[model samples]
Target: MSLSVEEVRRRVAADWNGIVDVLDEKIALRSVSAEGIAGENMERSARFVADTLRKVGVDARVEQATGADGKPGAWEVIGEKIVDPDAPTVLLYAHHDVQPVPDPAEWNTDPFVGTVVGDRLFGRGSCDDGAGIAIHYGALEALGDDLGVNVKVFIEGEEEMGSPSFIPFIEAHRGEFKADVIVVADSGNWAPDIPSLTTSLRGNATCDVHVRVLGHAVHSGQYGGPILDANTVAAMLISSMYDREGNLAVPGLEGCEPIGGLERDVDELGLRADTGVVDSYELAGTGSLASRLWTKPSMTVIGFDATPVKDSFNVIAPECTFRLSVRVSPVQAPHAALEAIQVFCEEHAPFGAEVKVTMLEEGMGWAMDPDCAATKDAETAMAEAFGTAPVNMGQGGSIPFIPELQRIFPDAEVLVTGPEDPQSNAHSPNESVSVSGLEKDVVAEALLLDKLAHKPEPTNL
Candidate 1:
C-alpha cells in the first residue's frame, strides 16, 4: 500500500528523538580517513550504520574494500529491503566518513561531541552526511515493512578521503546495489530555508607536476642572474593556467550556460567560504557567478613542494613539484580534460624547463536529463516538503561516485538532494545541520519513494 504524506510526516516526527540520537552517536565517533589518521573509527562507524539499519528491518553488513593504492581500504555498509521483485528500486547513498579535525581548538565545541544550539546541531559530519544517514533510516521507518518499492542503502566510509576505492567496491557488489533510481544525499541546498534539487555537478582531475630547470642545486647568489630556478619556472607554469581576468586559460574545454532561474548571492558565498572579498575584487572567470562556479572548468594549485619559507637557503632549487587540481565542466570528459591540462603544462613551461605531469585521480561529472518522469515526481515531493518549488541547481563540487553510479545503472534517474544548506559549513570546522531541514528531507524522500512506487514498472536500460 502507498503511504500518504501525512503518514510520512507523523512517522518523521515520532522518530525525531531517535533520529537525533543516531546522528549524535555517529558524530561521537571520530571516523576520519585522511593520511596518518586512524581507520578504526571509520570501521566502527560503518558497523554502527549497518547495525542501525538491521534494527529497522533491513539486512545489512559492513564490507571492507581495497584502496586505490592497492592496500586495505576503509569499510562500507550496504543494506537492502526488498518489498517486491517487480517494484521499482531506489538506491540511497551517503557517506559515513568525516574529515580530519585539524585542530580541536578551532571548533567552538568539541567536533565529535555534538551540541544542540536552538535549531542547529553542530559537529563534524553532522550535516555533511550524518543527517543523510538519519534521513534514509527515518524514511524507511515511516514507510514501515511494506514499502511498496525496494530500497538499497549504501553508506560509504572513505568519501572524505576522495572515495579512492568506490569504483572497485561497487563493482564487486554490483548486483546487490542495483536500482532503478539513485538518490545521492551528499550535496547542499541553495540556502537554509530554501531546498534545491541538484541538477548538475562538476568533474575533477588531479595530477602532480614536476619542473626541472637545473640538474643540481646552484648557489643563487652566484648563478641566479642567468640560470633558471625550478621554483620560479613551476610558478610561471601554474600561473599560466589562469588568464589576466583569472579565468581558466586551457583551450578546448566546454561549459554549459546556467539555466534561466538559477541564482546565488556572491556576498553569501564569500561569507560561507570566509573569504572577505573587497568591493573591487572582481569575481573570477566569465558568465554568471553560478555558471562560472558550476559549469566552467577551473584549476587550483593544491600543494607545492618548494623551499620552505622557514628553512630557506640562498640556493637555486634543482626541481620543484606542484599538485594541480583541475575542476572540469559537467559536459567535459575527465580523461580529455586531464590530457588537456597535461599538454598545456608541458607546452607552456618557461625557459625550456623539463616538465612532466603524473595523473593522480580523474572522475567524470554528471547532469540529470530534463525530460525524465522521475524528476517531475521528485520535484513535486520537494515542493510539498519545503512549501516552495525546488530550483534546478548546479553544484560546483564533484562527487566521484555519482558518475560511477550513473555508469553502473544507465537507466536510473539520479536525484541529488540533502539536508545541508549554505550555513551547514560541511568539511569546515563548526559543521552543523538544521533540525527542521533534516525533518523536511525525511518527508521529501519518503514521499518520493511512495510516489515512485505507484508509477508503472521501470523501463529497461
Candidate 2:
C-alpha cells in the first residue's frame, strides 16, 4: 500500500524514536578515529547499519577500501537492491566515521554517550552526519512494504579523513554501483528552520613550508642577532602569503564571481561567525560572501611546529615548518594551485633562508548545475516537506569524494542536503540534532525519493 504524506510522517515519527535509540547505541560505541575506538568501533557501526538495512529487506554488504597511507583501515557499507534492473537508480551517500572526541570533560555529558536534552540528541557525529545516516535508514524502513524505487546506500568510514578510499572504491566498483542520481546528505541547511540545497563545495589543497636557516641550534647569547632564526624566517614567509588587507597574496590564484540569488548580509554575518572572528574585524575582499568563500582563493597557515615556548633559554632553531591549507575556486586546478603556492613561498622567502614547500594532499572542488531537473525535483520535495522554499548554497569545506562522484557520474544529477541545521554544532563539543529536524529530513527524503522515482529521464547535457 502506498503511504500518504501524513502516514509517512506518522510512520517516520514512530520509527525515529527507535532510530534515536539505535543512534544512542551507536554513539555509545565511540567510533573516534585513530584512538582507542577506531577501526573496531567503525566496523561495529557499519555492521549495525548493515544489519538495519538487512532488516528492511535490502541486500547489504561491507566493502573495505585501503587508506591513502596504504593502510587497511577504511570500509564502505553498501546496502542495495535493484528491484528492476531496467529502472534508473539513486545513490545515497553518508559517512560512518567521526572525529576524535578530545577532552570529554568539556561536554555536558560523555562525548561517547548520546544524551537527549529537550528536543535534541547530543553526541559526537550526531548532527555532523550520524543524524543523516539515521534518517536515511528511517526513510527506507518507512517505505518497507511499499518500496517504489531502486536505491543504493553507501556509508563510508573515512570521510573524516577526506574520504581517502572513496574514489578508488568507486572506480573499482563502477559498474556494480551505477546510479542516475547521487544524493549527498552530509551538509547542513542555511539556518535552523530553513531548507537548503548545497550546490558547490570549495576544493582543498595542503602544502607545508619548511625554512631551514641554521645548520644547528645555537645559544641565544651567542647567535641571537646574526644567526638568522629559522622560526622567524618561516613566520615571515608564511605571513607574507596574505596581504595587509587580509586578502591572499599568493600569485596565480584566481578569484570567483558570486552567483545570483544569494544575499550579502546573510553571507557576511554567517562567514564572520563561521570563522570564529568578531564582526568588528572587517574581512578582506569586496563582494558577496559566496564570492569570497566559494569563488575566491584563500590561503591559511594551519599550524607551526618548532621549538617549545616553555624552554628557558632561547636558541636559533635549525628548522621550522608551517603547514598551509589553501582553498581554491571550484574551477581552479589543485595541482596548479599547489604549484603556485610553492613557487610564491619560495620566491618570497625572507633573508635568503632555505625554503622548501611540499604538496601534502589535494582535492578538487565541485559545482553542481542548479538548473538540472533532479535539483528541481529535490527543491520541490524539500519545499513540500518543510513548507518553505529551499535555498541554493555552497560549502567552503571540501568533501573529497564530491568531485570524484561528479567525474564518475558525469551525466547524473547530484543534490546535497541533510537534517543538519546551523546550530547542530557538528565537529564540536555538544554536537546535536533536533528531533524536529530528524523528522523533517525523513519526510524530505521520502518525498524526494517519490519525486525522483516518478520524474522523467534527464536529458544529457
Candidate 3:
C-alpha cells in the first residue's frame, strides 16, 4: 500500500517533537571522544541509544570492538528488523562520538548542556552527528511497522577518531550485517534549503616533512647570510606545491569531470564569502567549483614545528618539520599518493638539504555509482520531498569509514545525505540545525525507504 504524502508528513511532524526531546537528553550527557566521559558514561550513551531503539520495536544490541592500538576502542549499537528477515536490508549509519569541547569561554552555553534558542539546538554534537542519530530514529519511528524493507541501524562511538575499529567490527560480522543499501547520515547538504547527495569524497593522506640544513643550530648574526636555513628551505618546498594561480602543481594529480546544472554565480559568491578570500583575488584555477573541490587533488600545510617564535630569535634553526595533508582523487590510491608526495618533497628540497618524509595516516576515497537502482530510488524520493531533483555533489572532506564500507559491501548501493546544511556550523562553536531542514530530511528518508522497498531492481548499469 502506498503511504499518502500527508500521512508521512503528519507522522514526521508528530515524531519530530519526541525526537527533539530524545536529542536533548542525549546531548545533555558529555560523550566527548575518549575523554570527559569514559567507562560508565560511554556505556551510558550507548545504552541510551540502544534502549531508544528497543522501545520503538527494533531489536537492538550493543557490541564491543577492539581497536587497532589494542585498546577497547569503540562500542556499536545495532538496531535490527524493520521488515522480514529474508528481505533486502538497508544499513543506516551514524556516530555517537563527538569532539571535546574547547575552552568553556568560547561557547555561548555549556557545550554538554543542550540549549534551545529560537529554532536552533545548541550543543557540541547537536549538528556534527548527534542530529544524525536523532534523524535516523525519527524516520524509523515515523515509518513504524509500516516499513516494507528491512532496515538496520549501526551507531558507532569511534567516528570522531577516524573509525579505526569499525572496519574490523564490520569484517567480523559481515554475515549478520549484509545490506542492499548504506545510508551514511554523517554528511550535510551543500547549501541550506537545497538537498544534495554526496556522490564523491576526496581521499586523504598525511605526512610529516623534516628538513635539516645544518648539523647544529648557530647564531643567526654569525651564520645568517651564507648558511642554508632549514626553515627557509622548508618554506620553499611548501610553496612549490602551489603555483601563482593557487593551483596544485603536484604531478599525476587528476581532475574530476565537471558537474553541470549548478548556479555558478551563486556558488562563486558563496565560496568567496565562506572562505573569506579577498574579492579581488581570483578563485584559483577552476573549471567548476565542484570539480576543483571534489575531483582535483589538493595539498595543505596543516602545521609546522620549529624554533619558537618568542624569546630570542638570533639563532639559525638547524631543523624544521611540517605536517602536510593531501586530498587525493576518489580514483587515486592513497599509498600511491603518499609515495608521490614523498618523492616530491625529496626531489624538491632546496640547497641539497636532507629531507625525510613520514606518513601519518592514509585512507582511500569513495564514489557512488549513480546508475544503481537504489540511487534512482533515493533521487526520486529526494525530488518528491524537495520539489526538484537532488544535486549530485562531491565532498572535499573524507569520511574515514566510507572506503571500508564499500570494500565490505562491494555490491551494495551507498547513499550519503542528511539534514545538515552549509550553515550548520558542524564541529565548531554554536552549531545548530533548522527545524524545517530536519523535517524535510525525515520525510525524504521515509520516502526513500518506501521507494526502495517497492521499486524493481535494476538489471544493468
Candidate 4:
C-alpha cells in the first residue's frame, strides 16, 4: 500500500491543535537541569512525556538515569510499540530538559507559558527540544498503532546540562535501544521556509582557569606598575589562545574543511545573533564565515571573576578566574582539544603567576555521512513537507548526546532535524518556534516512518 505524501500531510494538519496542546504542556514545565534549580520540573517533564506517549497507545515508562557522578540524574522516558517483530525499528530521540530562563523580565511573555502570537509559540524550550517532542508525538499519533515500522520513543531530561549520564544510560539498556534508524529532533534549519538536514556538529568542552599573582590584595598607589596584577596575567593567558587574526592558536586540535559549500547571508546571521559586525573589523578565522562557524574550532571566555568596577578602589587584585567555553571541530576529539587548551594555558602563564586549569565537561562532535537509504528517504520526506528541496547543513552547536547514540547504535542511520529557524532564538530571551514549521516537520517525520516501513531493511554496513 503506497502512502501518498498528501495523505500524511492531511493527517498532520488534522492533528495540529492536539500537537500544540502537547507542546504547551511541555513548555509549561520549567525542566531546567542547572545547579540549585528544583529537580521537580525535570522529573515532571519526563513523566509528562511518558504519559503523553502512553495516552497515544504506546507502552511507555519513566526511568531515572544516573549521572557521571554516580548519583541520580534526570528522568528518561522510554516508550516502545512493536507492531511487527519482522518490521524495521526506528527510534525517535529528543530532550525534555531546557535551559534556564536568564531573566523572565526580559521576555514579552512568561518564559514558562506557551504563548502564541502571530504564527509563533514563545516560551523557554519552545523551539529547541520542546518542538522535538511535539513533532515526534504528532507524527506517531497521525500514523496511529499500525505505524508500519516498530517505534521507540526516547526523551532525555538533562541534555542542556551536557548529557553527563547519556552514555551510561545507553549502556545499561543496550538491547532496548537498538534500531534501524534514529531520528534526532534537536537541530535547527537554515530558514523557516527551507528545511535542513544537519550533517555535522561541532564538539564542546569547558574548563575553569584560575590565575593568582599575589597572596593578598595590594593597594594600587603603593604597588603600582612594579607589581604584576592577576588581571593582567589572566588577560595575557587569554590573548595567547588567539593569534593576530583572532583564530584559535592552540596546537594539536586541527579543524576540518567544510564538506559542502554552505554560506549564509551575513545580514541574516547578524539579525539572528542580535548583533552586527562592524565594517571596519575583519571577520575572525580562515575561510568563509560559514566554515569558520560550522567547521573550525572556536574559543570563548564564557565567564570571568574579578572585582566589580562599581566597587573599585584602586587595588591590585589577588586573583582572577575564567571559564573557558571551547567549541572543537566535528573531526576532532573533545579530549584532545581540551588537552591542547590546558597545555596552552600552562605554557603561556605570564609573570610567574600561579595558573590552575580544571576540566569541567566535554562532548564529542559528529559528522553524518548521508548516503544511506534511510537518510535519502528522510530528505525526500522533508522536501515534500516543506515544498522545497532540503539542504544539507552544518550546526555549530553541540548536541552531546548524539555522539553517544552513534557509538551505541553503530549500524543505525541517524538524521538530525528540528522545527527551529534562526528567529526561534533558542536558549535566549523570547525563545520560540514557528507553528507552521512544527506542522511541516510532523508531516515530514510521519512520511519518513511510512516510507521506511515499505523499504528493505537497512544493511549492517
Best candidate per lDDT, number? 4
Error of 1 at 255 (Å): 2.2
Judging by TM-score against the true structure, name the best candidate: 3
User: Clashes per prediction?
Assistant: 0, 1, 0, 0
What are the lDDT scores of the predictions, listed in order? 0.84, 0.78, 0.80, 0.85
Q: In candidate 1, which residue pairs get closer than 3 Å at backbone N, Cα or C atoms, i.e. clash? A: none
Per-residue lDDT of model 1, residues 1-461, tens digit only: 56667778888899889989999999998787774223677788899999988878789998888876778887889989988998889898999888878988988888998799888999999997899999888888877865878889899888887777888988989998888889999887766667778878899989999999888999999999888789888888888778888888787767776533455533445643566667666567666777887778888889999989999989999999999888889999988988888889888888889999999888899887766878888889888877887766887889878998899889889899888887787888889999888888888888898898887657999
Model 4 TM: 0.88
lDDT of 1: 0.84
Shift of residue 456 alpha carbon in model 3, Å: 3.6
RMSD of 3: 2.7
lDDT of 2 by residue, 1-461 (tens): 33567877877877877778767876776766555223677788788778877877778888777655777767578878677776668888888778887778888877888888888888988886787788778878777766667889888877887665778878888876678888889998866566888867888999888899878888888868877788878878867877777778788887666443463334566656766897577777666667777668887888988767786356778898889898888878888999998898788889888889889989898887867888888888777777788776777778878888988889878888877777787888888888776778778888777766675557999
| Poorest 10 consecutive residues by lDDT, candidate 3 | 257-266
Models 1 onward score TM values of 0.89, 0.88, 0.92, 0.88
